[model samples]
Target: MGLLLLLPIVFVSNALVPTQRMTPWLRDLTTWNPISAVTAAARELLGNPNPAASIDAWPMQHPVHATPIWSSDY
Candidate 1:
């Protein structure tokens, strides 16, 4: 059940597939997804190749700052 639920979010994130091809609404979701923020933060902190997003959404744009926000129970 958990895997099934998580699968959709994982698939929709910028993790596996590039979000560039998605529709605007979906792209928005991808940008706001905590998974995306985490991924970006990880890539950035690890000095990996993080792709530049044209969207400029807060999470993707500022993942290092966004991760703690997403991790908190608000």
Candidate 2:
């Protein structure tokens, strides 16, 4: 049930649409999204090209550091 609810959120998050392409408000939303932080951290760890590279958001820039903070909040 939780997974179902979160599925649409994943599409709305930076996972599907690159942060750079979203509106400023949307980009900010995705920037603070825990999923985005996790995805960014994972991409960083896996050596994959980050889709949020073009955005100058702090979370995208320091995903490794953001991951711990994001996790603690949940």
Instruction: Give candidate 1 misplaced runs (Cα > 4 Å).
Output: none
What is the Å distance of residue 68 in model 2 from its true position?
Answer: 1.5
lDDT of each: 0.84, 0.82
Residue pairs of candidate 2 with colliding backbone atoms: none
lDDT of 2 by residue, 3-68 (tens): 999887787677766777678887888888878988888988999998876668788889899889
Residue-level lDDT tens digits of model 1 in 1-74: 99999889888788877777899999888989988888888988999877734557878778999999999997
Model 2, runs deviating above 4 Å: none
For model 1, the local distance difference test gives 0.84
Return the clash pairs for model 1, or none. none
Which 10-residue window of candidate 2 scores lowest in summed lDDT?
12-21
